[model samples]
Target: MSAMNKKRTESTETLKKVLRFIGRYRILLVVSIVLAAASVLLQLYVPILFGNAIDQIIAEQKVNFSQMWRWLRQVLLVVLFSGAASWIMNLINNRIAYRTVQDIRAKAIRHIQKLSLSYLDSHSTGDIISRITADADILSDGLLLGFTQLFSGIVTIIGTLVFMFSRNVVITIMVIVLTPLSFFVAKFISSHSFQMFQRQSSARGQQTALIEEMIGNQKLVQAFGYQDKASERFARINEELRESSQQAVFYSSLTNPSTRFVNNVIYAGVALAGAFLIPGGALTVGGLSVMLAYANQYMKPFNDISSVITELQNALACAARIFALLEEKPESPDPSESLSDVKGSVEIDQVSFRYTPHRPLIENFNLKAEPGRRIALVGPTGCGKTTFINLLMRFYDVNSGTISVDGKPVDQISRHSLRSSYGMVLQDTWIKNGTVRENITIGKPDASEDEIIQAAKMSHSWEFIRRLPDRLDTVITEDSLSQGQKQLLCITRVMLCLPPMLILDEATSSIDTRTEMLIQEAFDRLMQGRTSFIVAHRLSTIRNADEILVMKDGSIIEQGTHDELMKKGGFYHTLYNSQFVNTAE
Candidate 1:
């Protein structure tokens, strides 16, 4: 109903999420808390020791040297034990902080893997990475600070109050009267700052996404002479991020000073109260000294806690982003049935789908491929060519109708089995940062040396592979190879598996003509006795395909062999002639 109430509710939810992560290390947390309390209590006892020693040495000549030595020794042991406890507490806190962060990041990655492809297609990769990396790091910092300061501050506050009450009730009451002011100040500032911190985190994610997009496509930006526009866009996002961050920081930063002012007032009250009590014989000089020490210790926790609250607000904001990602609904569960020994018979009956319900991309798409049949899909960009392939692979479920493999619906089979049965090579190549052997053997990890070499040679990638420093063992990255080389490796990966079905999406678009011919020959040999779907933009590439389906705006306009379509003079015929006509120009 109110802003403060809403802020409290959000913070509590975020805190509960954090506590679930922390709850995994319950034993370690308990040990850390015990050590923190022990350390604070020991430190509180030191002030009493100082008061005793001070009272004993009222005069320098009459000072009890033996008595002082004993007290000094006890003080030394207390300090040593307190330092040890604090050090160990810090070590355990570090372990918990880092390990909790590790769990959150790992869970985020695992959840991302389970998410539907549609979700990933709609979201930015850079933003996901920022939440897992940068946001998680901030959470780790907050956890570490909370463990180190929050626990110790609470213990110090409680212990100081107990010690002060045993010495003088009047001074203790005076200190207690001013304590609420610090909490009120912290709560007021934190309430206003929480929303700003949330805004800052979202802006940070946007900036990360923009940077990733620009850097990832730097060549495209430069080639199109759009660098100035890109820079301007980045500047706008950067300015937004700066303004949000500045406001959040400015609001949170007020907590420390405002609370410190209240703490000082409390301290001044203690000093004045103790000073008046000494004249009435209600307190001794040693008692006054102890009261002053307790007052400082009491106020120190409030100051430290106010700062912790500020950090907690920022940390919770980041945690909320990460949690939002984790909360996304995962893909529906697959049936218990698993496809095995796939015969490559695919049937798409009345299949209809769209990214958005308002705009149809594929409607009533129907296709049936018997074993060893090759189906070619040809269309302009955004005509549902790739979307069809995505549906076939079960990347996205159809909005209507059934897609079956070997008489069983795709949804009835495990996704892992359905996907693994098909060998796919797309134009957009992906090469993980690893060795040449690793990349080639990704589809079939246990592939032998001979099998890997044979696949590489078949794909025509062995020519470049043999030239590398370590051949199969050479550590290579995506940037280390040319585009064509990367595509060749992707082709080799599929070639190694030689699955029951195949999908070639402009597989040779990046290779030169000579290499393309060789790879095409290899593909011909590989496609034998295997059902295949090819999405080709170059009309000439699909001339030999068994059945070419011409698609336009989510509908198949024509379907026939190249000669049949050419004789009929349909859309395929026009599209076929247009390519040669453009080349002639």
Candidate 2:
């Protein structure tokens, strides 16, 4: 197929998707259509009233006060009703359009929440946000304008054409001949402009992603003195966006003027034709005037439609992006088997995995932790310590192995139940803009005020919490608290839950050494009678762990207590010595 044909097909599909949302609010849509038709009918008849008043004046050779007065009142009443109907229609359109878009946004967000971690890890945060907010808004605005203009424009064009046919067929024929010229111009420009608008939309998303990334990591950028590099990178993307936007606007902008030019030519033809007919008694002055008015009304709809079409192209492009996100496969279905009466005895058997097919990351890893054991995974960076934890958490499934907790394969258990059995505190903390109590109680919402305070105190977070302006109720803005405070809040959240299993991935990395000791003491109490896996680069933290598994390149090279591993004088010995040696120097 030709490029235009391909675009037309895609546009039709996008339009169908948009109409599905409209179909959801069909009742409001029907009412809006009725109002629009009523407005168009009322407006269409006003020109007839004007023609009658003109003929009465001409026939009397003076102002026919009674006839003209009656015509004036009819025209005024029509104008008033038309304006009221149009206003009501607009109000209904806005309600229906906005409500439908709101529903779409909600559904998209819910789907995003259910998406697998793998999917999220592979996508950019800013792009996903842009699709949900910016692109969705564009679709909403476009639908609103399209619906408002589409019904009225079509009704006006058809109603005016009917009136013109009744008054004079010759002038109507002239109009019929010229109408296609306007449509052709609109179609030609829109076809090319659609691709440009799509490009512009993509560029805008890229720019938004860059801005979100830079702003989110502004501290890092500034700290590293890479502000100029960030600015230059942003400038390049911004320039591309500007060029795409300019091209898209330039082409779509041609639609209105080009259609208007055709309408003007058709109007000139109508005037010329009406002049010859007036002398032959084929047309009265009033009839000629009504025909000209009808001609203007008929052509005006084309201009309105053309503009709507151009805007719709941009909206459809954005809709396509949003729908693409919604179409992603959600998390795998949950199994009927579930963990119950959980005692955290995690066992990894002959596990083999790879992020990519050809390059192996984890190979035949094996381990067993009895209930309530503190198993520390110590390894050099990229030696699969974190990857092992990810497997146990079931964030990524192993290629060939079974990770079981309490004699049940992880895959056999429902993800919700499996994940709820563990309380995790990672090195990177996630704190939302909410009250301090809310952030701490997120893991266990039913936690009472006293319970929340107790958890905070146990995690060494209550000292700072009590000093805040509102204490526990103080809202935590993004920049309101320090990184260590955020990590403390995360740990406090874990303490409140008190799950059967715990995973701490460098949980105290952000805290100062003094606070770390206090938090460590608190964690010592918290880890009692729970299976805990601690992943830490600081070997000092896990020296007293029950069993320290020294990992190297996806396999366990050593497994014993901290002293036993150090006495063996191998990879763990070297790793431990290097850390303390660095500290001593």
Candidate 3:
């Protein structure tokens, strides 16, 4: 199919989706439609009243004052009623428009929660935010305009046609012949502008993504002297956005004026026809007045519609992006069965996985961790140590073979139940905007104040917490606390829960040496009766671990206690000595 046809098809589908959302408030929509129609019909009757009063004044000496007064009063009543109906219609339209926007935003947020980590990792945060906020607002504007203006415009056009035919069919035929010109003008302009509007929306998303990136990492940008480069990149995107927006607005702006010109021709044609017929006495002066009025009314809707076509196109483009997000495939669903008695006995048998099939990352990886065993994973970067942790937590599943906890395959258990059985503390700590108490109680919300304090004390964070002005109630944001404090808070969460299994990926990387030793002592007590997997780069930290697995190129090259590995003088011995050599230097 042609490009125009493809766009038309996509637009039709997007319109259908929009209608379905509006359908949720079908009762209110119907009321708005009825009021719009009533308003237009009442307004249409005013011209006929004026026309009748005009005929009453055929001659100054032959004027009927009482009859003209009655017609004039009726016209006043019609105008008042039309205005009232129009007001109520607009109120209902506002309600529908805002509520639909709310629903769409809520749906997008809920869908984002269900999406897989891979999908979110691949998409830009700013683009997703733009789709939810900016796009939804644009759609709200379009819906409001469509409901308030489009409905009444259509009714006004049809009502005028009926009124005009009743007065003088000959002149009505002339108006009808010229009416299509207005529609043709609107259609031609809108068709070309739609593509430009789509381009504008895309560029706007890219600009948002870049702004978000720069704002979130401003320190890095300054430290690396990337301000000039970032600004240059932004300028390029901004220029593209400006060009697309200029072209879109230029084309869409033509619709109103072009349609208005056609409407004027139609109006002039009606007047000329009416003038010729009046001399023949086939039409009265009042009849001619009514026909001219109807002619203007007939073309008014086309003008109104043409003016709003810009918003309609923009709204459709935004809706398409939101729907694309909603269409993303979520993570695989879990089974109904949940893990009931998690003993932390994890076993990986012949597990093989790769992020990209062409480049293997983890192949035939196998391990068995008995209950209460401390397994330390030491490896160079890019050796799949973190990937292995992700597999155990079921963040990413293995490509082949079974990974089981307590003899039950991880895939066979419900994700919520399986994940809750383990406590994880990673190198990158996340602190939300909340009070210290609230952030610490995330793992176990029902924990008492005493329990919260005990966990904080165990994690070596209570001393710092007590120093704050508000203690545990102090609201903290991402930037409110130092990196070490944030890591302590994250560790506090694990201490509070104390799940059967633990995964610590350089959990103390941000803390000072003294705090690290203190937290490590607490961690030792915490791991006394739990199975734990620790991924560490500092070989000295894992010296006392029950077993150390030295990894290279995604495979384990050495597995033994620190003393046994050192006795062998293999890969682990060299790695351990290298770390100590760097520390001494």
Candidate 4:
């Protein structure tokens, strides 16, 4: 109901999510805590043994070698066992923390794969990457520190308090009275630092996105001579990041020293109280020494926990962002109806769609392509050419429409199966860092070597491939190949599949005129007897299409064969003539 209550609720939810990961590895976590407790208990016994040795020497009124030797042996054994347990606990904690974070990272990646294209289009790639890599790393580090210190710190504090109370109740009460000072200081500082840490994490994601954008478009920036402008823009973002980071670190940094200062004051009060008790015959000299030791031990956990709380706040902020991304709803559920015997007869019935609700892009659009027909979509730049293709692929669902293949509704089929039926080549090519052969065979992974080579030859890509060192096996980076070469590889990929339907969205836009002609010939062969949809800016490329649809403002203004539309001198004729006249000039 209130702001404070809302904040508390959100924090509790985030903490629960983080604890779920720990709970998944609960067995290992429990073992780690047990080992840490044993280690702290052994460590706490050493001070008592030392105090007994002091009291033995005082009672004997001389150096007692036998008692001194026994106490020395006990103390040494305790130290040895405590160190071993601490080491084992650390190893177990490391395994639990790393494995848990690894599982979380894996789940995030798999979830991203299932997300719809709309989500990807709206979010920055760099921000997503930061969440998976950098944010996950922060969480892992924080968990490791927390697991290593949390159980042991609590155990040490409790054990030390018990030892202090047994030796001197008066002094123990004094220590208890001052303990809350350190805790209050830690709590006050941490609450103020939490929001600052969250802001820093967000700013870091923004900076990462900006860096990715700049690096991805470095060539364009250089070609346009906008390096200085780009640098200035980056400088502005960097300044914001700096300010946020400084503020966050500044606030969190206060927690440790502030708590330490309070603990020091508590230690001083305990020593002063011990002096008064020793003067009264209520406390012995050895008892006072043990009390001082217990007092220091009791305050140590507070300081350790206060420092860890700062780091935990940062980790919580990162975890909250990561969980938000994971919580996004994936694509709509696939229907039970399977797509069988796809014949590539696509039908769009009264489809209406838009990226936003208020501004409609494609309204009441309809098209029908019979089996084996090649449909050409020609339109101005802003016309819904690509949007139409996106809907057909179900990359984005249409607002009001039914797209069917062979009378089967597209929505009824699984997205994977529906997309598998179509072979696509776009003007923008994506090639990973791999061998040329591997890149070409991506669409059809099981294609025989001969089939791969044949597809490459048909697409006119083999000519350049043969010239490369190792030919098809040659590894190629993104910058190693020319634009036309990349386009040919993409076309070759599509050809290897030989799917039932084809969609070429300006597939030849990047190639030279001669290369375009050769690729078009390959496409013609590839499209034979299979329905094809071609979106081309070069009007000449689609002259032989079975049907041409002239589009404007998201609606088809004219539709007919090339010669039939040319004879009518309608929108198609005007578009064709303008391109022809521009080429002539």
Candidate 1 lDDT tens digits, 1-585: 888788789889999999999999999999999999999999999989888877787675888778777878889999999999999999999999999999999999999989999899999998998999999998999889999999999999999999999998878887888899899989889888879988899999999999999999989999999999999989998999999999999989999999998888888888888888889999888888899999999998888888888898899999999999999999999788888888999999999999998998899989999989899999888999999999999999999999999999999999989999999999999999999999999879999999999999999999999999999999998789999999999999999999999999999999999999988899999999999999999988888889999999999999989999999998888888999999999
Tell me, by lDDT, which candidate is best: 1
Cα lDDT of all candidates, in order? Answer: 0.92, 0.91, 0.91, 0.89
Off by over 4 Å in 3: none
The residue-by-residue lDDT of candidate 3 on 41-65, one tens digit each, is: 9999998999999999968699999
Model 2 stretches astray by more than 4 angstroms: 1-4
Clashing pairs in 2: none
TM-score of each: 0.98, 0.96, 0.98, 0.97
Which scores higher on lDDT, 1 or 2?
Answer: 1
lDDT tens string, model 2, 1-585?
A: 998789788888988987897799899889998999999999999989999988887645577779988998999999999999999999999998899789889989999988877789888889899988988899988989998998999999988888888888878988998899999999889888888888888988888899999998988999999999999999999999999999999999999999999999999999999999999999989888998889999999999999999999999999988888888999777898889989999999999998878988899999999999999998888999998888888888889989999999999999889998999999988998999988888879888999998998899999899999999999988688998999999999999999999999999999999999999998999899999999999999998799999888889989999889888999899998998899999
Q: Tell me the spans in candidate 1 whose CA falls farther than 4 Å from its real position.
A: 2-4, 59-61
By lDDT, is 3 or 4 better?
3
Error of 1 at 423 (Å): 0.8
Residue pairs with colliding backbones in model 1 are none
User: RMSD of model 2, in Å?
Assistant: 1.8
State which candidate, 1 or 4, has the greater lDDT.
1
User: For candidate 4, what is the TM-score?
Assistant: 0.97
